[model samples]
Target: MLQVLVSRKIAVAESICSFELCSLNGEPLPPFTAGAHIDVQTPAGATRQYSLCNHPEERHRYMIGVLKDPQSRGGSQAMHEQVEQGQTLTISEPRNLFPLAADGKRHLLFAGGIGITPMLAMAYELSQRGVDFELHYSFRTQASAAFLDVLAEAPLARHVRLHDNAAATQLDAATVLAAPTPGTHLYVCGPSGFMNYLLSTAASQGWPAEQTHREFFAAAPIEHDGDQPFEVELASSGQTFHIPADRSVFEVLDEAGIEIETSCEQGICGACITRVLQGTPDHRDQFMTDKEHAVNDRFTPCCSRAKTPRLVLDL
Candidate 1:
Protein backbone atom coordinates (compact mmCIF):
# COMPACT_ATOMS: atom_id res chain seq x y z
CA MET A 1 0.00 0.00 0.00
CA LEU A 2 1.12 3.54 -0.69
CA GLN A 3 0.41 6.61 1.43
CA VAL A 4 -0.89 9.29 -0.95
CA LEU A 5 -2.32 12.71 -0.28
CA VAL A 6 -5.57 13.71 -1.87
CA SER A 7 -4.40 16.83 -3.63
CA ARG A 8 -7.55 17.88 -5.40
CA LYS A 9 -11.23 17.07 -5.19
CA ILE A 10 -13.30 18.38 -8.07
CA ALA A 11 -16.98 17.90 -8.70
CA VAL A 12 -16.90 16.55 -12.20
CA ALA A 13 -20.62 15.84 -12.49
CA GLU A 14 -23.81 15.44 -10.56
CA SER A 15 -23.11 13.23 -7.54
CA ILE A 16 -19.70 12.40 -8.89
CA CYS A 17 -16.27 13.56 -7.69
CA SER A 18 -12.87 13.13 -9.22
CA PHE A 19 -10.02 12.70 -6.75
CA GLU A 20 -6.44 13.51 -7.64
CA LEU A 21 -3.98 11.61 -5.47
CA CYS A 22 -0.36 12.61 -5.32
CA SER A 23 2.45 10.78 -3.62
CA LEU A 24 3.35 11.92 -0.12
CA ASN A 25 7.04 12.04 -0.95
CA GLY A 26 8.50 14.09 -3.77
CA GLU A 27 9.15 10.91 -5.77
CA PRO A 28 6.93 9.89 -8.67
CA LEU A 29 4.19 7.43 -7.86
CA PRO A 30 3.95 3.93 -9.30
CA PRO A 31 3.24 3.57 -13.02
CA PHE A 32 -0.13 2.28 -14.13
CA THR A 33 -1.45 1.33 -17.53
CA ALA A 34 -4.89 2.10 -18.89
CA GLY A 35 -7.84 0.17 -17.38
CA ALA A 36 -6.03 -0.18 -14.06
CA HIS A 37 -7.60 0.27 -10.64
CA ILE A 38 -6.26 0.92 -7.14
CA ASP A 39 -7.77 -0.33 -3.94
CA VAL A 40 -8.50 2.69 -1.80
CA GLN A 41 -8.93 2.36 1.94
CA THR A 42 -12.05 4.38 2.54
CA PRO A 43 -12.52 6.38 5.75
CA ALA A 44 -15.06 3.81 6.96
CA GLY A 45 -12.33 1.14 6.73
CA ALA A 46 -13.80 -0.46 3.64
CA THR A 47 -11.55 -1.19 0.67
CA ARG A 48 -13.04 0.14 -2.58
CA GLN A 49 -11.52 -0.36 -6.00
CA TYR A 50 -11.58 2.75 -8.22
CA SER A 51 -10.27 2.85 -11.77
CA LEU A 52 -7.56 5.31 -12.83
CA CYS A 53 -9.13 7.81 -15.18
CA ASN A 54 -5.99 9.76 -16.05
CA HIS A 55 -3.68 8.94 -18.91
CA PRO A 56 -1.28 6.08 -18.33
CA GLU A 57 1.69 8.28 -19.27
CA GLU A 58 1.11 10.36 -16.16
CA ARG A 59 3.22 9.34 -13.18
CA HIS A 60 2.99 12.37 -10.90
CA ARG A 61 -0.45 11.40 -9.64
CA TYR A 62 -3.46 9.17 -10.12
CA MET A 63 -7.00 10.31 -10.85
CA ILE A 64 -10.13 8.31 -10.03
CA GLY A 65 -13.73 9.26 -10.73
CA VAL A 66 -16.25 8.07 -8.18
CA LEU A 67 -20.05 8.36 -8.31
CA LYS A 68 -21.85 8.62 -5.00
CA ASP A 69 -24.07 5.58 -4.75
CA PRO A 70 -27.17 6.19 -2.75
CA GLN A 71 -27.03 2.58 -1.53
CA SER A 72 -23.33 2.63 -0.72
CA ARG A 73 -22.20 -0.25 1.46
CA GLY A 74 -19.53 2.02 3.09
CA GLY A 75 -17.01 2.92 0.35
CA SER A 76 -18.63 5.80 -1.57
CA GLN A 77 -20.50 7.11 1.46
CA ALA A 78 -17.36 7.76 3.52
CA MET A 79 -15.43 9.06 0.51
CA HIS A 80 -17.97 11.80 -0.05
CA GLU A 81 -18.68 12.48 3.62
CA GLN A 82 -15.33 12.30 5.45
CA VAL A 83 -12.53 12.40 2.87
CA GLU A 84 -11.08 15.85 2.28
CA GLN A 85 -8.74 17.30 -0.31
CA GLY A 86 -5.76 17.32 2.04
CA GLN A 87 -6.41 13.98 3.73
CA THR A 88 -3.95 11.15 3.40
CA LEU A 89 -5.21 7.83 2.09
CA THR A 90 -3.85 4.32 1.91
CA ILE A 91 -4.06 2.88 -1.58
CA SER A 92 -2.86 -0.32 -3.15
CA GLU A 93 -0.73 -0.54 -6.26
CA PRO A 94 -2.43 -0.53 -9.66
CA ARG A 95 -4.00 -3.80 -10.80
CA ASN A 96 -5.47 -4.27 -14.26
CA LEU A 97 -8.15 -6.88 -14.82
CA PHE A 98 -9.81 -4.89 -17.61
CA PRO A 99 -6.83 -4.44 -19.91
CA LEU A 100 -7.15 -3.39 -23.53
CA ALA A 101 -6.81 -5.77 -26.47
CA ALA A 102 -3.64 -4.24 -27.85
CA ASP A 103 -3.30 -6.75 -30.69
CA GLY A 104 -6.76 -6.22 -32.08
CA LYS A 105 -7.32 -4.75 -35.54
CA ARG A 106 -9.97 -2.33 -34.27
CA HIS A 107 -11.60 -1.45 -30.96
CA LEU A 108 -15.13 -0.42 -29.97
CA LEU A 109 -15.43 1.13 -26.53
CA PHE A 110 -18.70 1.71 -24.68
CA ALA A 111 -19.21 3.65 -21.50
CA GLY A 112 -22.30 4.12 -19.31
CA GLY A 113 -22.43 6.72 -16.55
CA ILE A 114 -19.48 6.38 -14.15
CA GLY A 115 -18.25 3.41 -16.16
CA ILE A 116 -16.69 6.00 -18.43
CA THR A 117 -13.82 6.28 -15.96
CA PRO A 118 -11.74 3.41 -17.32
CA MET A 119 -12.87 4.03 -20.88
CA LEU A 120 -11.25 7.47 -20.61
CA ALA A 121 -7.91 5.89 -19.82
CA MET A 122 -8.30 3.36 -22.62
CA ALA A 123 -9.12 6.11 -25.10
CA TYR A 124 -6.03 8.06 -24.00
CA GLU A 125 -3.77 5.06 -24.44
CA LEU A 126 -5.36 4.02 -27.72
CA SER A 127 -5.05 7.55 -29.05
CA GLN A 128 -1.43 7.65 -27.97
CA ARG A 129 -0.84 4.43 -29.86
CA GLY A 130 -2.61 5.94 -32.89
CA VAL A 131 -4.92 2.99 -33.16
CA ASP A 132 -8.38 2.77 -34.69
CA PHE A 133 -11.01 2.94 -31.96
CA GLU A 134 -14.32 4.62 -31.14
CA LEU A 135 -15.88 5.37 -27.75
CA HIS A 136 -19.64 5.53 -27.25
CA TYR A 137 -20.76 7.02 -23.97
CA SER A 138 -24.32 6.83 -22.60
CA PHE A 139 -25.76 8.75 -19.73
CA ARG A 140 -29.18 9.68 -18.38
CA THR A 141 -28.40 13.35 -19.03
CA GLN A 142 -25.42 15.49 -19.87
CA ALA A 143 -25.41 16.89 -16.31
CA SER A 144 -25.18 13.37 -14.88
CA ALA A 145 -22.19 12.58 -17.10
CA ALA A 146 -18.63 13.08 -15.90
CA PHE A 147 -15.70 14.42 -17.88
CA LEU A 148 -17.59 15.95 -20.80
CA ASP A 149 -14.86 18.54 -21.23
CA VAL A 150 -12.16 15.93 -21.08
CA LEU A 151 -13.93 14.00 -23.81
CA ALA A 152 -14.39 17.17 -25.80
CA GLU A 153 -10.73 18.19 -26.05
CA ALA A 154 -8.16 16.93 -28.49
CA PRO A 155 -6.84 13.33 -28.42
CA LEU A 156 -10.34 12.13 -27.31
CA ALA A 157 -13.00 14.35 -28.82
CA ARG A 158 -13.15 12.93 -32.35
CA HIS A 159 -13.19 9.32 -31.23
CA VAL A 160 -16.15 9.83 -28.88
CA ARG A 161 -19.91 9.69 -29.51
CA LEU A 162 -22.19 10.97 -26.79
CA HIS A 163 -25.62 9.38 -26.21
CA ASP A 164 -27.73 10.76 -23.43
CA ASN A 165 -31.11 9.22 -22.63
CA ALA A 166 -32.81 12.58 -22.94
CA ALA A 167 -31.52 12.87 -26.53
CA ALA A 168 -32.93 11.04 -29.53
CA THR A 169 -29.56 9.62 -30.54
CA GLN A 170 -29.34 7.19 -27.62
CA LEU A 171 -27.00 4.23 -27.97
CA ASP A 172 -28.30 1.61 -30.35
CA ALA A 173 -26.31 -1.45 -29.33
CA ALA A 174 -27.91 -3.71 -31.92
CA THR A 175 -27.07 -1.36 -34.81
CA VAL A 176 -23.61 -0.48 -33.53
CA LEU A 177 -22.86 -4.16 -32.99
CA ALA A 178 -24.19 -5.25 -36.37
CA ALA A 179 -20.88 -5.77 -38.12
CA PRO A 180 -18.36 -8.31 -36.82
CA THR A 181 -14.77 -8.28 -38.01
CA PRO A 182 -12.42 -11.15 -37.29
CA GLY A 183 -10.07 -9.01 -35.19
CA THR A 184 -12.47 -6.30 -34.08
CA HIS A 185 -12.80 -6.10 -30.29
CA LEU A 186 -15.50 -4.72 -28.03
CA TYR A 187 -15.17 -3.32 -24.53
CA VAL A 188 -17.86 -1.94 -22.22
CA CYS A 189 -18.30 -0.68 -18.68
CA GLY A 190 -21.35 0.73 -16.95
CA PRO A 191 -24.51 -0.55 -15.34
CA SER A 192 -24.88 -4.33 -15.22
CA GLY A 193 -27.99 -4.35 -17.38
CA PHE A 194 -26.41 -2.14 -20.04
CA MET A 195 -23.24 -4.22 -20.16
CA ASN A 196 -25.23 -7.42 -20.35
CA TYR A 197 -27.39 -6.19 -23.19
CA LEU A 198 -24.43 -4.98 -25.24
CA LEU A 199 -22.42 -8.09 -24.60
CA SER A 200 -25.38 -10.28 -25.41
CA THR A 201 -25.96 -8.33 -28.61
CA ALA A 202 -22.35 -8.75 -29.59
CA ALA A 203 -22.53 -12.42 -28.84
CA SER A 204 -25.66 -12.82 -30.93
CA GLN A 205 -23.88 -11.03 -33.76
CA GLY A 206 -21.18 -13.76 -33.68
CA TRP A 207 -18.57 -11.72 -31.80
CA PRO A 208 -16.14 -14.10 -30.19
CA ALA A 209 -15.85 -14.03 -26.41
CA GLU A 210 -12.06 -13.73 -26.59
CA GLN A 211 -12.46 -10.47 -28.50
CA THR A 212 -14.62 -8.88 -25.78
CA HIS A 213 -13.65 -7.60 -22.34
CA ARG A 214 -15.45 -5.72 -19.58
CA GLU A 215 -15.25 -4.32 -16.05
CA PHE A 216 -18.28 -4.16 -13.80
CA PHE A 217 -18.85 -1.39 -11.26
CA ALA A 218 -20.72 -3.73 -8.98
CA ALA A 219 -21.83 -7.34 -8.78
CA ALA A 220 -25.48 -8.17 -9.14
CA PRO A 221 -27.12 -9.26 -5.92
CA ILE A 222 -27.01 -12.99 -5.36
CA GLU A 223 -30.20 -14.70 -4.34
CA HIS A 224 -29.69 -16.80 -1.22
CA ASP A 225 -33.23 -18.05 -0.99
CA GLY A 226 -32.08 -21.63 -0.65
CA ASP A 227 -28.59 -21.28 0.70
CA GLN A 228 -27.06 -24.05 2.77
CA PRO A 229 -24.01 -24.56 4.97
CA PHE A 230 -20.91 -25.91 3.28
CA GLU A 231 -17.47 -27.21 4.26
CA VAL A 232 -14.02 -26.24 3.03
CA GLU A 233 -10.80 -28.17 3.47
CA LEU A 234 -7.46 -26.44 3.06
CA ALA A 235 -4.95 -28.22 0.88
CA SER A 236 -2.05 -26.85 2.91
CA SER A 237 -2.88 -28.31 6.32
CA GLY A 238 -5.81 -30.53 5.44
CA GLN A 239 -7.77 -28.62 8.06
CA THR A 240 -11.51 -28.31 7.57
CA PHE A 241 -13.67 -25.25 8.15
CA HIS A 242 -17.41 -25.01 8.17
CA ILE A 243 -19.00 -22.05 6.37
CA PRO A 244 -22.38 -20.94 7.55
CA ALA A 245 -25.10 -20.14 5.08
CA ASP A 246 -25.30 -16.51 6.17
CA ARG A 247 -21.51 -15.96 6.07
CA SER A 248 -18.93 -16.03 3.33
CA VAL A 249 -15.86 -18.22 3.04
CA PHE A 250 -13.70 -15.13 3.50
CA GLU A 251 -15.19 -14.31 6.90
CA VAL A 252 -15.04 -17.93 8.07
CA LEU A 253 -11.41 -18.31 7.01
CA ASP A 254 -10.40 -14.94 8.47
CA GLU A 255 -11.87 -15.95 11.78
CA ALA A 256 -9.73 -19.08 11.74
CA GLY A 257 -6.52 -17.05 11.33
CA ILE A 258 -6.50 -17.24 7.58
CA GLU A 259 -6.06 -13.91 5.80
CA ILE A 260 -7.28 -13.63 2.24
CA GLU A 261 -6.37 -10.39 0.54
CA THR A 262 -9.62 -8.87 -0.67
CA SER A 263 -11.14 -5.69 -2.06
CA CYS A 264 -14.59 -4.92 -3.43
CA GLU A 265 -16.25 -7.49 -1.21
CA GLN A 266 -19.13 -7.49 -3.68
CA GLY A 267 -17.11 -9.90 -5.88
CA ILE A 268 -16.45 -7.40 -8.65
CA CYS A 269 -12.69 -6.94 -8.04
CA GLY A 270 -11.40 -10.51 -8.39
CA ALA A 271 -9.20 -9.90 -5.30
CA CYS A 272 -10.03 -12.90 -3.16
CA ILE A 273 -9.90 -15.47 -5.95
CA THR A 274 -9.01 -18.86 -4.43
CA ARG A 275 -8.09 -21.98 -6.32
CA VAL A 276 -10.49 -24.88 -6.04
CA LEU A 277 -8.79 -28.24 -5.70
CA GLN A 278 -12.07 -30.09 -5.80
CA GLY A 279 -15.86 -29.58 -5.74
CA THR A 280 -18.01 -27.06 -7.54
CA PRO A 281 -18.54 -23.41 -6.63
CA ASP A 282 -21.73 -21.46 -6.97
CA HIS A 283 -19.99 -18.68 -8.83
CA ARG A 284 -21.50 -15.34 -7.77
CA ASP A 285 -18.92 -12.88 -9.03
CA GLN A 286 -19.07 -10.65 -12.11
CA PHE A 287 -15.25 -10.45 -12.19
CA MET A 288 -14.81 -13.84 -13.84
CA THR A 289 -16.03 -14.46 -17.35
CA ASP A 290 -18.66 -17.10 -17.96
CA LYS A 291 -16.03 -19.34 -19.57
CA GLU A 292 -13.81 -19.10 -16.49
CA HIS A 293 -16.72 -19.80 -14.20
CA ALA A 294 -17.58 -22.91 -16.22
CA VAL A 295 -14.17 -24.45 -15.44
CA ASN A 296 -14.98 -24.42 -11.73
CA ASP A 297 -11.28 -24.49 -10.89
CA ARG A 298 -11.37 -21.26 -8.90
CA PHE A 299 -13.79 -18.90 -7.18
CA THR A 300 -13.93 -15.63 -5.30
CA PRO A 301 -14.30 -16.41 -1.61
CA CYS A 302 -15.49 -12.91 -0.82
CA CYS A 303 -19.04 -13.62 -2.03
CA SER A 304 -19.06 -16.96 -3.87
CA ARG A 305 -20.39 -20.01 -2.12
CA ALA A 306 -19.90 -23.73 -2.59
CA LYS A 307 -22.18 -25.97 -4.61
CA THR A 308 -21.02 -29.24 -3.14
CA PRO A 309 -21.37 -30.01 0.52
CA ARG A 310 -17.62 -29.58 0.85
CA LEU A 311 -14.96 -27.90 -1.28
CA VAL A 312 -11.27 -28.64 -1.33
CA LEU A 313 -9.42 -25.35 -1.55
CA ASP A 314 -5.83 -25.00 -2.68
CA LEU A 315 -5.31 -22.66 0.27
Candidate 2:
Protein backbone atom coordinates (compact mmCIF):
# COMPACT_ATOMS: atom_id res chain seq x y z
CA MET A 1 0.00 0.00 0.00
CA LEU A 2 1.19 3.50 -0.86
CA GLN A 3 0.12 6.52 1.14
CA VAL A 4 -0.58 9.51 -1.09
CA LEU A 5 -1.91 12.96 -0.54
CA VAL A 6 -4.67 14.36 -2.69
CA SER A 7 -2.97 17.48 -3.96
CA ARG A 8 -5.82 18.75 -6.10
CA LYS A 9 -9.44 18.03 -6.86
CA ILE A 10 -11.31 19.67 -9.71
CA ALA A 11 -14.82 19.18 -10.99
CA VAL A 12 -14.14 18.36 -14.59
CA ALA A 13 -17.78 17.77 -15.54
CA GLU A 14 -21.30 17.88 -14.18
CA SER A 15 -20.87 15.09 -11.64
CA ILE A 16 -17.31 14.01 -12.31
CA CYS A 17 -14.32 15.14 -10.27
CA SER A 18 -10.70 14.65 -11.26
CA PHE A 19 -8.23 14.17 -8.43
CA GLU A 20 -4.48 14.50 -8.53
CA LEU A 21 -2.73 12.30 -5.96
CA CYS A 22 0.90 12.82 -5.12
CA SER A 23 3.24 10.75 -2.99
CA LEU A 24 3.36 11.68 0.71
CA ASN A 25 7.04 12.33 0.15
CA GLY A 26 8.15 14.30 -2.90
CA GLU A 27 9.33 11.15 -4.66
CA PRO A 28 8.61 9.69 -8.05
CA LEU A 29 5.68 7.27 -7.87
CA PRO A 30 5.69 3.73 -9.12
CA PRO A 31 5.59 3.34 -12.92
CA PHE A 32 2.28 2.39 -14.53
CA THR A 33 1.18 1.48 -18.01
CA ALA A 34 -1.49 3.28 -20.03
CA GLY A 35 -4.54 1.30 -18.91
CA ALA A 36 -3.46 0.77 -15.32
CA HIS A 37 -5.77 1.34 -12.34
CA ILE A 38 -5.15 1.74 -8.62
CA ASP A 39 -7.30 0.35 -5.85
CA VAL A 40 -8.23 3.28 -3.63
CA GLN A 41 -9.16 2.58 -0.03
CA THR A 42 -12.00 5.03 0.28
CA PRO A 43 -13.11 6.76 3.46
CA ALA A 44 -16.13 4.44 3.53
CA GLY A 45 -13.73 1.50 4.01
CA ALA A 46 -14.41 0.20 0.54
CA THR A 47 -11.57 -0.62 -1.83
CA ARG A 48 -12.65 0.86 -5.13
CA GLN A 49 -10.61 0.72 -8.33
CA TYR A 50 -10.19 3.84 -10.40
CA SER A 51 -8.42 4.12 -13.72
CA LEU A 52 -5.39 6.38 -14.09
CA CYS A 53 -6.32 9.08 -16.56
CA ASN A 54 -3.06 10.97 -16.76
CA HIS A 55 -0.22 10.13 -19.09
CA PRO A 56 1.84 7.22 -17.77
CA GLU A 57 5.14 8.92 -18.58
CA GLU A 58 4.38 11.54 -15.94
CA ARG A 59 5.56 9.62 -12.87
CA HIS A 60 5.39 12.37 -10.26
CA ARG A 61 1.66 12.00 -9.64
CA TYR A 62 -1.38 9.95 -10.63
CA MET A 63 -4.69 11.38 -11.78
CA ILE A 64 -8.09 9.69 -11.53
CA GLY A 65 -11.60 10.77 -12.47
CA VAL A 66 -14.47 9.82 -10.21
CA LEU A 67 -18.11 10.11 -11.13
CA LYS A 68 -20.75 10.64 -8.48
CA ASP A 69 -22.78 7.61 -9.35
CA PRO A 70 -26.35 7.68 -8.19
CA GLN A 71 -26.30 3.91 -7.83
CA SER A 72 -23.07 3.84 -5.92
CA ARG A 73 -22.30 1.45 -3.08
CA GLY A 74 -20.83 4.29 -0.92
CA GLY A 75 -17.38 4.36 -2.57
CA SER A 76 -18.21 7.02 -5.14
CA GLN A 77 -20.34 8.91 -2.64
CA ALA A 78 -17.44 8.94 -0.20
CA MET A 79 -15.04 10.29 -2.79
CA HIS A 80 -17.48 12.97 -3.85
CA GLU A 81 -18.55 13.99 -0.38
CA GLN A 82 -15.80 13.20 2.12
CA VAL A 83 -12.53 13.32 0.11
CA GLU A 84 -10.83 16.66 -0.21
CA GLN A 85 -7.59 18.24 -1.38
CA GLY A 86 -4.54 17.64 0.87
CA GLN A 87 -6.22 14.59 2.35
CA THR A 88 -4.20 11.39 2.64
CA LEU A 89 -5.38 8.21 0.91
CA THR A 90 -4.08 4.68 0.83
CA ILE A 91 -3.82 3.22 -2.68
CA SER A 92 -2.49 0.00 -4.06
CA GLU A 93 0.18 -0.16 -6.75
CA PRO A 94 -1.12 0.29 -10.29
CA ARG A 95 -2.29 -2.88 -11.98
CA ASN A 96 -3.29 -3.27 -15.64
CA LEU A 97 -5.86 -5.90 -16.52
CA PHE A 98 -6.82 -3.77 -19.50
CA PRO A 99 -3.54 -3.24 -21.35
CA LEU A 100 -2.80 -2.13 -24.87
CA ALA A 101 -1.78 -4.80 -27.34
CA ALA A 102 1.97 -4.60 -27.88
CA ASP A 103 1.82 -5.61 -31.53
CA GLY A 104 -1.36 -3.98 -32.77
CA LYS A 105 -0.83 -1.77 -35.81
CA ARG A 106 -3.90 0.34 -35.13
CA HIS A 107 -6.08 0.84 -32.08
CA LEU A 108 -9.74 1.80 -31.76
CA LEU A 109 -10.97 2.88 -28.36
CA PHE A 110 -14.59 3.24 -27.30
CA ALA A 111 -15.60 4.93 -24.08
CA GLY A 112 -19.02 5.44 -22.55
CA GLY A 113 -19.69 8.08 -19.92
CA ILE A 114 -17.16 7.69 -17.06
CA GLY A 115 -15.44 4.83 -18.85
CA ILE A 116 -13.30 7.39 -20.70
CA THR A 117 -10.84 7.47 -17.79
CA PRO A 118 -8.57 4.64 -18.91
CA MET A 119 -9.02 5.44 -22.60
CA LEU A 120 -7.73 8.96 -22.00
CA ALA A 121 -4.45 7.57 -20.67
CA MET A 122 -4.20 5.19 -23.61
CA ALA A 123 -4.73 8.10 -26.00
CA TYR A 124 -1.90 10.03 -24.39
CA GLU A 125 0.46 7.07 -24.61
CA LEU A 126 -0.49 6.33 -28.21
CA SER A 127 0.00 9.94 -29.20
CA GLN A 128 3.37 10.06 -27.49
CA ARG A 129 4.45 6.87 -29.24
CA GLY A 130 3.19 8.17 -32.62
CA VAL A 131 0.86 5.19 -32.99
CA ASP A 132 -2.31 5.06 -35.03
CA PHE A 133 -5.37 5.34 -32.81
CA GLU A 134 -8.83 6.85 -32.63
CA LEU A 135 -11.14 7.44 -29.68
CA HIS A 136 -14.94 7.60 -29.70
CA TYR A 137 -16.35 9.02 -26.50
CA SER A 138 -20.10 8.87 -25.78
CA PHE A 139 -21.88 10.74 -23.07
CA ARG A 140 -25.41 11.78 -22.11
CA THR A 141 -24.80 15.44 -22.87
CA GLN A 142 -22.10 18.02 -23.44
CA ALA A 143 -22.39 19.22 -19.86
CA SER A 144 -21.88 15.68 -18.55
CA ALA A 145 -18.88 14.96 -20.78
CA ALA A 146 -15.68 14.76 -18.74
CA PHE A 147 -12.34 16.19 -19.88
CA LEU A 148 -13.74 18.00 -22.93
CA ASP A 149 -11.39 20.94 -22.51
CA VAL A 150 -8.46 18.68 -21.76
CA LEU A 151 -9.19 16.52 -24.78
CA ALA A 152 -9.58 19.58 -27.01
CA GLU A 153 -6.14 20.80 -25.97
CA ALA A 154 -4.48 17.44 -26.57
CA PRO A 155 -2.13 17.01 -29.54
CA LEU A 156 -4.25 14.07 -30.71
CA ALA A 157 -7.50 15.96 -30.35
CA ARG A 158 -8.33 15.52 -34.03
CA HIS A 159 -8.44 11.77 -33.57
CA VAL A 160 -11.28 12.00 -31.05
CA ARG A 161 -15.00 11.97 -31.83
CA LEU A 162 -17.68 12.88 -29.35
CA HIS A 163 -21.33 11.81 -29.42
CA ASP A 164 -23.94 13.28 -27.13
CA ASN A 165 -27.40 11.79 -26.81
CA ALA A 166 -29.03 15.15 -26.09
CA ALA A 167 -27.93 16.43 -29.50
CA ALA A 168 -29.24 13.30 -31.25
CA THR A 169 -25.66 12.43 -32.14
CA GLN A 170 -25.55 8.78 -31.19
CA LEU A 171 -22.91 6.20 -31.91
CA ASP A 172 -24.14 3.45 -34.19
CA ALA A 173 -22.21 0.34 -33.21
CA ALA A 174 -23.32 -1.39 -36.41
CA THR A 175 -21.78 1.29 -38.58
CA VAL A 176 -18.65 1.70 -36.48
CA LEU A 177 -18.02 -2.03 -36.17
CA ALA A 178 -19.05 -2.97 -39.68
CA ALA A 179 -15.94 -4.89 -40.54
CA PRO A 180 -12.89 -6.21 -38.77
CA THR A 181 -9.61 -4.68 -39.91
CA PRO A 182 -6.44 -6.71 -39.98
CA GLY A 183 -3.87 -5.82 -37.30
CA THR A 184 -6.35 -3.45 -35.69
CA HIS A 185 -7.40 -3.91 -32.08
CA LEU A 186 -10.48 -2.62 -30.31
CA TYR A 187 -10.70 -1.68 -26.64
CA VAL A 188 -14.01 -0.90 -24.96
CA CYS A 189 -14.78 0.26 -21.44
CA GLY A 190 -18.34 1.16 -20.61
CA PRO A 191 -21.58 0.25 -18.85
CA SER A 192 -22.75 -3.30 -19.19
CA GLY A 193 -25.55 -2.50 -21.64
CA PHE A 194 -23.35 -0.33 -23.87
CA MET A 195 -20.55 -2.88 -23.75
CA ASN A 196 -22.88 -5.70 -24.64
CA TYR A 197 -24.15 -3.81 -27.64
CA LEU A 198 -20.63 -3.03 -28.86
CA LEU A 199 -19.36 -6.57 -28.29
CA SER A 200 -22.36 -8.25 -29.90
CA THR A 201 -22.11 -5.90 -32.86
CA ALA A 202 -18.39 -6.51 -33.17
CA ALA A 203 -18.88 -10.27 -33.07
CA SER A 204 -21.55 -10.07 -35.75
CA GLN A 205 -19.13 -8.08 -37.91
CA GLY A 206 -16.45 -10.79 -37.80
CA TRP A 207 -14.25 -9.36 -35.06
CA PRO A 208 -12.18 -12.05 -33.43
CA ALA A 209 -12.28 -12.58 -29.67
CA GLU A 210 -8.53 -12.07 -29.17
CA GLN A 211 -8.53 -8.68 -30.94
CA THR A 212 -11.20 -7.23 -28.69
CA HIS A 213 -10.43 -6.09 -25.15
CA ARG A 214 -12.71 -4.78 -22.45
CA GLU A 215 -12.85 -3.69 -18.82
CA PHE A 216 -16.09 -3.32 -16.88
CA PHE A 217 -16.60 -0.81 -14.10
CA ALA A 218 -19.00 -3.27 -12.49
CA ALA A 219 -20.51 -6.60 -13.27
CA ALA A 220 -24.11 -6.73 -14.44
CA PRO A 221 -26.38 -7.95 -11.69
CA ILE A 222 -27.08 -11.61 -12.29
CA GLU A 223 -30.13 -13.48 -11.09
CA HIS A 224 -29.49 -16.03 -8.36
CA ASP A 225 -32.63 -18.08 -8.83
CA GLY A 226 -30.57 -21.04 -9.99
CA ASP A 227 -28.02 -20.71 -7.21
CA GLN A 228 -27.96 -23.53 -4.66
CA PRO A 229 -25.87 -24.58 -1.70
CA PHE A 230 -22.63 -26.30 -2.59
CA GLU A 231 -19.51 -27.70 -0.99
CA VAL A 232 -15.88 -26.81 -1.72
CA GLU A 233 -12.99 -29.19 -1.04
CA LEU A 234 -9.35 -28.17 -0.69
CA ALA A 235 -6.87 -30.28 -2.60
CA SER A 236 -3.85 -29.55 -0.37
CA SER A 237 -5.70 -30.31 2.84
CA GLY A 238 -8.47 -32.91 2.82
CA GLN A 239 -10.96 -30.43 4.14
CA THR A 240 -14.37 -29.43 2.90
CA PHE A 241 -16.68 -26.55 3.67
CA HIS A 242 -20.32 -25.93 2.90
CA ILE A 243 -20.99 -22.78 0.92
CA PRO A 244 -24.49 -21.54 1.56
CA ALA A 245 -26.45 -19.87 -1.24
CA ASP A 246 -26.40 -16.57 0.63
CA ARG A 247 -22.61 -16.67 0.99
CA SER A 248 -19.91 -16.65 -1.68
CA VAL A 249 -17.09 -19.16 -1.88
CA PHE A 250 -14.60 -16.46 -0.95
CA GLU A 251 -16.60 -15.62 2.15
CA VAL A 252 -16.78 -19.26 3.19
CA LEU A 253 -13.04 -19.73 2.68
CA ASP A 254 -12.24 -16.61 4.64
CA GLU A 255 -14.45 -17.83 7.47
CA ALA A 256 -12.35 -21.00 7.53
CA GLY A 257 -9.12 -19.01 7.94
CA ILE A 258 -8.25 -19.15 4.26
CA GLU A 259 -7.02 -15.94 2.72
CA ILE A 260 -7.15 -14.91 -0.93
CA GLU A 261 -6.06 -11.71 -2.61
CA THR A 262 -9.12 -9.86 -3.92
CA SER A 263 -9.67 -6.37 -5.28
CA CYS A 264 -13.03 -6.22 -7.00
CA GLU A 265 -15.47 -8.59 -5.29
CA GLN A 266 -17.91 -8.08 -8.15
CA GLY A 267 -15.88 -10.52 -10.25
CA ILE A 268 -14.63 -7.92 -12.70
CA CYS A 269 -11.04 -8.27 -11.48
CA GLY A 270 -9.17 -11.57 -11.81
CA ALA A 271 -7.31 -11.19 -8.50
CA CYS A 272 -9.16 -13.99 -6.69
CA ILE A 273 -9.20 -16.41 -9.59
CA THR A 274 -8.28 -19.90 -8.29
CA ARG A 275 -7.33 -23.06 -10.10
CA VAL A 276 -10.03 -25.79 -10.24
CA LEU A 277 -8.66 -29.27 -9.76
CA GLN A 278 -11.96 -31.09 -10.23
CA GLY A 279 -15.71 -30.55 -10.87
CA THR A 280 -17.43 -28.08 -13.17
CA PRO A 281 -17.88 -24.50 -12.04
CA ASP A 282 -20.84 -22.24 -12.54
CA HIS A 283 -18.72 -19.43 -13.90
CA ARG A 284 -20.21 -16.02 -13.14
CA ASP A 285 -17.29 -13.67 -13.59
CA GLN A 286 -16.99 -10.97 -16.25
CA PHE A 287 -13.18 -11.05 -16.25
CA MET A 288 -12.62 -14.27 -18.21
CA THR A 289 -13.66 -14.85 -21.78
CA ASP A 290 -16.16 -17.49 -22.82
CA LYS A 291 -13.35 -19.73 -23.97
CA GLU A 292 -11.66 -19.56 -20.60
CA HIS A 293 -14.92 -20.40 -18.84
CA ALA A 294 -15.48 -23.32 -21.17
CA VAL A 295 -12.04 -24.72 -20.24
CA ASN A 296 -13.19 -25.03 -16.57
CA ASP A 297 -9.57 -25.21 -15.33
CA ARG A 298 -9.91 -22.06 -13.23
CA PHE A 299 -12.65 -20.03 -11.56
CA THR A 300 -13.18 -16.81 -9.69
CA PRO A 301 -14.54 -17.68 -6.25
CA CYS A 302 -15.68 -14.18 -5.46
CA CYS A 303 -18.94 -14.59 -7.40
CA SER A 304 -18.71 -17.99 -9.03
CA ARG A 305 -20.26 -21.16 -7.61
CA ALA A 306 -20.13 -24.82 -8.38
CA LYS A 307 -22.28 -26.46 -11.03
CA THR A 308 -21.86 -29.82 -9.39
CA PRO A 309 -22.50 -30.75 -5.76
CA ARG A 310 -18.88 -30.06 -4.82
CA LEU A 311 -15.87 -28.22 -6.25
CA VAL A 312 -12.32 -29.45 -5.74
CA LEU A 313 -10.09 -26.35 -5.64
CA ASP A 314 -6.33 -26.47 -5.91
CA LEU A 315 -5.92 -24.44 -2.75
Q: Estimate the overall C-alpha local distance difference test score of candidate 2.
A: 0.93
What would the TM-score be for candidate 1 when compared with the true structure?
Answer: 0.97
Clashes of each: 0, 0
Cα lDDT, all candidates: 0.93, 0.93
lDDT of 2 at 87: 99
Candidate 1 lDDT by residue in tens digits, 153-186: 9989999999989989799998999978888889
lDDT of 2 by residue, 1-315 (tens): 999999999999999999999999899999999999999999999989999999999989999999999998999999999999989999999999999999999999999999999999999999999999989999988999999997888596888988887887899888988778888999999888888988889999999988999999999887899689999999999799999998999998998889988999989978899999999999999999988899999999999999999999999
TM-score of each model, in listed order: 0.97, 0.97
Off by over 4 Å in 2: none
